[model samples]
Target: MRGEGSAASAAGGISGGDGGASGTVPPPRGGSRRGGSRRGGGPANRRGRRRVLRWVASVLSLLILGTGAAGYLYYRHLNGSIQTDALNLGETKLGGSKPNAFGQTPLNILIIGSDARNDAANQALGGATETFDGPPLADVQMLLHLSADRSNMSVVSMPRDTMLMMPKCTEANGTVHEASKGLVQTNESLSRGGPGCTVAAWTELTKIPIDHFMMIDFKGVVSMADAIGGVPVCVEQNVHSRTRDGKGSGLKLPAGTTNIQGEQALQWLRTRYGFEDGTDIGRTHAQHQYMNSMAREFRKNAKLTNPVKLNSLAQAAIEAMVVDPGLNKIDKLFDLSMELKKVPPGRITMTTMPWIYSTRPGLDGRVEPKAGEAEDLFRMVREDIALDGQGSGTPASAGSSPAPSASAPGTAGTAQSAPPAATAAAPAKIAVSVRNATGGKDGAQAKAKGRATEVATLLAGKGFTKAVADTQTGAEDTTVVRFATDRQAADAAALATALGLPASSVEKSGEVPGIVLYVGKDWRTGDAPPAPAPAPTKAPDSAHPLNGDNDKACMAIQPGFTW
Candidate 1:
């Protein structure tokens, strides 16, 4: 939110696109109002009811998805409500996702919750009325990944207080916001341009292609909460998120399970001090609880069968969001909803980016991405490997890179078998960026000095004369060879193979210009990278993954805030 350089990291869901049943959109077939239909429980009616209810489940897919796809019936009016903008304002756009063996590709959308007090409704919802008409801040950022099979989904949230290098972004109106001098709070990236800039920062950080973006402000969360009915949640003790000088969310709830809706629902998600240790990280955990509970409650609610309620919720949501041009139309949105509907709640996994406070003196309060585990987590998503540790891939137990297995381009963890020999351009012709990512694990400094140049020289000696070393340094637990396009996959694989790295150590990244070979701590002094480590069998505890079907989840109140 950073409305006060802060954020509520509002509850998120897939945003919707159409209007209510009363509007222009047609009612779902086979089902009709009780008085309007002579045969109430006919086969078609049953089918229609199931179909209609499934659509509802998809829209409320989470905090944002459920609210986004429901309003197309009003057609023109609902369409007008959806504000469209440029998709990616970054200088270089990543290529499209490669399809699986079945010609299916995964879907990636960035959900942004902005803290904009431009209008009265927003000003009230986002308190601090004095700061009206201020620049919007993306307080909440979540990356939603729908697998190529459409059988599983993963959501990764970036805490608002995270510190990262903001990429250089250019606005549609010809305004240029130079990249930050150093790492800045992730929320501040929104002010660099618009949501596209935030999109740019994410792509740069995670090296994932962002197909679309949906942004909603404080009021949008409040409006959609009513349509979601009451979401059941449990607390360990009676807690109040309030302080002596009015510095908390003002939420007071008795211990145990309770149904929450409307502003109280919003408060439930926004209250940080009462939920945990009063940090943004703890608030992120609370948000996950709300989202998971919402998905479960939505699936069981009988009211979801009513097309009227679905449309109303959908309309209110699309009207409140700013989306990329790719999702501006109703049919496109409906199509997205259908894909989301295919993924059951049990297959959905939600995680917050594992992070630790910045060690830099002035920025110690700000958080930085946790090492190793975070990299492994992102690698799993890039490969369409479900974080819930199910299906296709090796067990998710230890590390990410599997032992050299196939010659294929990096994707679809199971379908990595490429041609017997994937062809690559001549060694001299390929442009490779060799970066030194040595050390930093367990409080170790970058001990391998000139490692990037040494590796670059090694590549040159091997006939890859175009290999160049980057001056910037980073921390990588193990060595990895990353490439941009699929065409470059063969070359990347060739490089990894040359370095004796495993097939799993080679990955596809959207932000790289070409192939990047990072000499990590694992290969600090050796000519060849280390052998592939064991793959992880489960998500680490630091990620705090919450599955949609887990109804037993309960938030523990902070000792200071609890009764």
Candidate 2:
């Protein structure tokens, strides 16, 4: 009922008849032309005019009827694409029930852009051969958080290079893998198990339950963009890049507003080397901007008022999306679309989960979130609160109530215990070093190390018997918690929560080869010994960068795999 006005109007336009709400009537046939001079017109001219009017009316009626039929067909197609089998009601995690300023329920959706090319259609898109290259990776991972009141939304992109514990996944092909036995890449989970595994990994890593998921791939994106004509985007500078397959997928645009469609839109989303940092994080911002621009264009364009175009866009979107089974239902999608329509583009915010680059001993360089930063982010969503500019928030200081904890042990307020059996592994012996990232002339670095030592001691108290505190480093402005291995990292997460540390304050890095606690300027030391400065690594630039070719291929194959 809240959206009845818009929904009714939209529906009326599709129904091939006027709703009478606009107060306009169809003109009477030949009334204006004939006027009072009907006698002045010859019989032949009158007949011809009448015939022409009748033909025009017939054509207009057919057009309206055709539009209505198309709309009905599109709605039916959308209903069919919903995968009921893919719905995991029990697995869905809702953020806290706290209402935002607008008093709406806040929702977080995990959008996965998979790289699997197992499907024939997907393989064709990526130009794949039959050499068992494994399914495509989930090159693009975004957590879209909508405010409780549905007035504000934020899309946070998680870098795939981010090193975190991957939950054991059960692939759609019926293959089961154990979490402890294998070291998995973040994006690989999508290929191994599908979106469900990706969801599990996210839940395990962030401790935040995902409510729904929407997956889209290349063709769908292209078609959808084309259907809406083209989306206008602003680039600060010129951008040029090639696709992974050595194709000329270069993006050439001036430093101004440009309307891009078809492959060009895809290219813009895929262009990395020409963008800032040349990382997936850079592309995330570009995509966010594109989405924002598209939303604005959609709202401003009266062409969508044409039932045919509206039906085309809707069909394209539905066909391209792979949704959780729970969302496959028409009623559910209808409700969601209605809710989404209420929120304007300006209200939507986009950001990347803040991260720092770190190099692992054997593994390649990876991006890691600053310590406790991710946790704080999750907590903000749980409490339906907006994050600060730095993605930092204090539960107590924010004056918001805490969210309900998972009934499972080790969650908020739950009895302190080990992680779930599926996630538990042998703890590793590791030393932690905490340093002040914020530059200061004072003994701030030492002070940060002291907090790190305190965290280390807290971990030791919580069954991480070998946890030891080490010295601080002169890392700039970012707080991070590094781990030696996947097992120790998961242990650290549990320990951090038990110690009442913010989740955002906890981070896991595969690079340090041991636990290192890096405290930011925001952290304070408690009753713990001050740690020593940590040994710096070798020349930082020598670290192995990501395989750019593989990365491009992974990006190109994403849209098809997910959809």
lDDT of each: 0.64, 0.46
Q: lDDT for model 1, on a 0 to 1 scale? A: 0.64
* Prediction 2 TM-score vs. true: 0.55
TM-scores of the candidates are 0.73, 0.55
User: How well is each residue in 167-208 modelled by candidate 1, as lDDT tens digits?
Assistant: 788898889888777777787777888989989888877767
For model 1, the stretches where C-alpha displacement exceeds 4 angstroms are 1-77, 91-94, 305-309, 392-525
CA lDDT, candidate 1, residue 109: 84
Top candidate on lDDT is: 1
